[model samples]
Target: MSAIFYIDQLPNRTIDHDGQAYLFFSGTAYLGIPQHPDFHQLMAESMRRYGTVFGSSRNGNVRISVYEEAESMLATRIGAESALTLSSGMMAGQVVINWLQSQHYTFVYAPKAHPALWHAPTVTLPQLAFADWTAQLPGQLSALSPGPVAILVNSLDAVCSDYYDFDWINQLPDNRPITLIVDDSHGLGVLNNGRGIWPTILQKSVDKPASVRIVGTGSLAKGMGLPGGVVFGDANAIQSIRQTAFFGACSPMPPACLDAFLRADALYAEGQERLQRNIKLAEHLLLPTGLFHQASGYPVFFTEHDALYANLLQKNILIYSFAYPTAADRANTRIVISAFHEVADIEWLAESIFG
Candidate 1:
């Protein structure tokens, strides 16, 4: 239980640990980008064309069109006025924190929110569930008026995969100005038909522009299967980060990753449908066993049963158990279903869990 090891190679769906083939269920590449040979060829072409890392300042006289190409596509798809690419999600979180810090805004966070947001001047009501916070948001806004307040949340939680219901934000009392920052790392490629949470949130908040300021930040690593992170928002907010954010001083994101990102729109379209189908297969089979619960359309399961975790492993199925960076309370076995997974693979894992 303590010394099993892993490495990435062929038959990526299964982990070779201590000379045994265990079904691997812990990867985050939801679309299974590596499985597409055409996509792989395109990525290889990009690597050849662009080299690897840029290793310099994007703010310098030199510029790469690939950054703009990917950011433009991302903004259009996410429904943001503009987007700024940073080195990583944690860096993007820092950029947002710095922006909010300069404005001296009060921050409120969801219990399961990313730890990066803890940097802000925050008020934590840990006893309140998400529903309670949403229900009481209007009044909280009223009492905290005469100052800017920000609410930071994981748009779709990584462990549970449940979204911070956009309808609740849309229902907020009118003219109550508040900044809403979303951590969308888990949602970018897998949610809303591969467009992410911002597009859907934008649609919901169409008539309330002055009431809500929507900001999204996340790594391209999770769903986009690319390198770096992004901060997306209205033009002013985006510019603030792009022009002078600390992340800019670091080496630019590897140009090779941007190469993959540029092709994601097309590959994602072909894969999202099958990925969704696989998720449903996971939902259908595992729920009946009483050992797991489906959390939204994503393959992640929230479970408290140690038997479910240990039994699945004994059956040679490998899944992730959350620790550290993932909130301690979210410690659960994650059964990942990728677009590359065969139907037989899905059924086998389900049967293993069912036993």
Candidate 2:
């Protein structure tokens, strides 16, 4: 049944289904902060400070400072020269692709990039085995493809949530003139001790003309429990996006969300610890179910997919089961765990799925 939520979906971490409260295990809020007292206060204070929407053009002389301030936090966290927030992570990707194509960049896609990325002029390379990244992807990228090449890759494959290694990105041959167009929507604030991996990647790759340049985009709506999208890179790339018609026409993020996000550093750190606990719980819960760990913020797919989906719901627990191109098998079934879940919630899901 189609339903409307009485609360923010992911942060609330509980769903009202059939007049019963079901533990919500369906969001990408790896650092679940919505239910936190601090988050509630932050949101309320934000509403008081900035009303609902800024609704002003950032291109104009006058714009919201929170925009830049929030972007600053994002850039600092990811170690980028600058950052921009757009309507969605997809918009951020669109901005990157548009700017790169305008600069004569061709596209090479890593396997299972989000469907949103395929809209660009892209060639899908054969799926390289995980280890092939250091050995294989580099060779492919090194080829003198026509024009500047943009390798669009997911830091974590959306299908099974496998983290693509960026460590070797710094090791690319100096002759390999490539820009890493990375979609980090899944990994930000969810992995690598809540700092994420992009900072390391960007820091490791220097600013030499022949060395690789990294442009990363992601969703704040997921792990950060906020609205809008982020694109961070060198000053030139961020400037290019700011000058675009897309930036001019798009609405800025809600002031309240930005306000809350700016004040959420502590909440995020605490939530990350809680999320780590939940991850461990999920690991233990599913250990005997024959479904191995896929990556952070998600669970594995197995023969128990159908039964577990129903059984978990019957036990007042809810996990998402949907068809995306990236599903573990052809089935597109999976489980998601969040910081909102307690040890009891994990235990309940385990018993329901395994029993």
Candidate 3:
């Protein structure tokens, strides 16, 4: 394995890694604000106003008005009724799973969904028989013992079907009640005109008999270029999860971090114009390689090749080579375009990839 090191050096969009500098075609800094000047200023101001850490959870002595305000903004953005802030998106998932376990509900999930969905103590449907999201969820729901069941879905996987199709998801047998939980960590800031998949699911899940619980988890670190996670859902469901023992036991995001996020939100709004530009650029750059095979919500294009990835890294470009759990398939790599990258950078990446 190659020795991993934190990126302490900033090279041009193309920089030297082993011996050559090449255009970077990988990694998930989608918005590219981590090193932006304005973001740096916001962080500096935040540090002065709100120290390094809050030292308590939302219910503790370190509570800040900004935390609540950020949550409200995020809820409004995602079209949820209320929102809760957490240390990370993984933590948000854990909170949701813990709550579901307390209710003693068996869970059925799309096999490609993030691991956090089934990592808790809940019973999961047989992994081999029901692995695909589009594989008729209603059939699986009918097979479960007569009782409450929760279905978790993720929209990020390349082979998975769209979870936003309301007509199909709501048709589960009327006799059995099921709650739908969606983890949109990858979908939140990059889909549905940037309003996210949460609001669409929330609106569609309203008439279900099982007392619909619509919850979404997102990380501000990805597209938003900030650190933190958000959980939003119906009012009562969020309240129930808050009472869990782990909910209030940890520290909250420092006011400074929240402040930086607030600024990042504004920058994100302005950065949309660049996002569109990069998407067009990527389509042109990657279409010829026959490797940019799929699109989920963002600009992370998937290609099947390990040597392409190692070559890119040798040129100092970082790309994500996340393999699917079912390893029998070909290894896939992801090509991400950051908002911080310029048009020249995109052209250079295209040349490098196709050279």
Candidate 4:
């Protein structure tokens, strides 16, 4: 079987297909805003205010004030000096990488780093676990000639529900300038009380010299429930990226989404609280079974059980199950808990799994 299922409507806590409704425990909607009535209402209202799309280039003569406003709000929320918004998370990374590449810095990538951070056509990643890669980074960086180096990595290993330690970043030698690019698509709006790992990374660099620079990029689609992406860094770095033809040439994110985001602070807080409660409930119910891997405070859980998907489907439940990154890779089956899931929905899922 191809392991594909199609449905007409978006999946939130439940998915309906072929006249059957199934408990949906999949997708990147950790905050569960897809079917959120409040968010929908906000979106509709924002559309009335900003229109569905702002079809002009960011560098055009007439500029929309909301982009700067939203970027400032995002920077304040994430504890960054500045922020830039884009159409998607992937473009956010490419925009950064494009600017960094122009500076002629040597690129060092972590194992299985997202393709958005890839700099060249023929790049090869080290065949090692993230821990092994982190442990060896200092040595590798020290070996390189003292010039410029860009280190790329993710805030968390989303595939296997693992969180990585980046204490090694602060311990690196300061002989060369270092730019750390973190793809926090899975971390922003979900980790560290919704501030994400930006604050933690800032703390790590507090004692370090000015040679080390940090840049955070990610998709707001997951936890934020926005169909856009963002980049966070110092003002100078952000200005350089903004000047690039790439940033100016690409279309901007929907003005309506940014408008809604600016006004959704209370709504986001409510969703985050609900998501935390659901995550705790799921941990209590599912962790003892020893059938999954998870990170503390993260909503996604993973299991290697090939039968779990079909089994859950039989019980009117649907989880994410598929080969990822490539067809040769082993299929990944995960159970994703969201804010939209009620206590009763979780209890039902547990009963089905345990049975």
Task: Please report, in order, the local distance difference test score of every candidate based on alpha carbons.
Answer: 0.75, 0.71, 0.68, 0.89
Weakest 10 consecutive residues, lDDT, candidate 4?
A: 1-10
Estimate, for each residue in 1-355, the C-alpha lDDT of model 4 and write its tens digit: 3357789989978888889999999898888776789989999999998898888899899999999999999999999999999999989999999998888889999987887788875468888999999888888988887689999999988988998887787687778889999999988888988888898888777776578888999998888899889999999999989999999998999999999998899888988999999999999999988898999878988998868999989998998888876676688888999999999999998889899
**Global Cα RMSD, each model:** 2.7, 3.6, 3.4, 1.4
Q: What TM-score would every model get versus the actual structure?
A: 0.90, 0.85, 0.86, 0.97
Sort by TM-score, best first. 4, 1, 3, 2
Which is the winner by lDDT between candidate 1 and candidate 3?
1
Q: Is candidate 2 or candidate 3 better by TM-score?
A: 3
lDDT of 3 by residue, 270-310 (tens): 56667767878888777778867656346777665657777
Candidate 1, residue 104: Cα displacement in angstroms equals 1.7
- Candidate 2 segments exceeding 4 Å error: 1-11, 121-145, 170-173, 203-209, 296-306, 325-329
Question: Which model scores highest in lDDT?
Answer: 4
Estimate, for each residue in 118-147, the C-alpha lDDT of model 2 and write its tens digit: 554544545666566457765676675655
Over 105-211, each residue of candidate 1 has an lDDT whose tens digit, in order, gives 88877666776566644445455667777788777777775777788888865675555667777665555467888888888888888878887887777776576
Identify the runs in model 1 with alpha carbons over 4 angstroms from their true place.
Answer: 1-4, 8-11, 34-37, 120-125, 171-177, 209-211, 245-247, 324-330
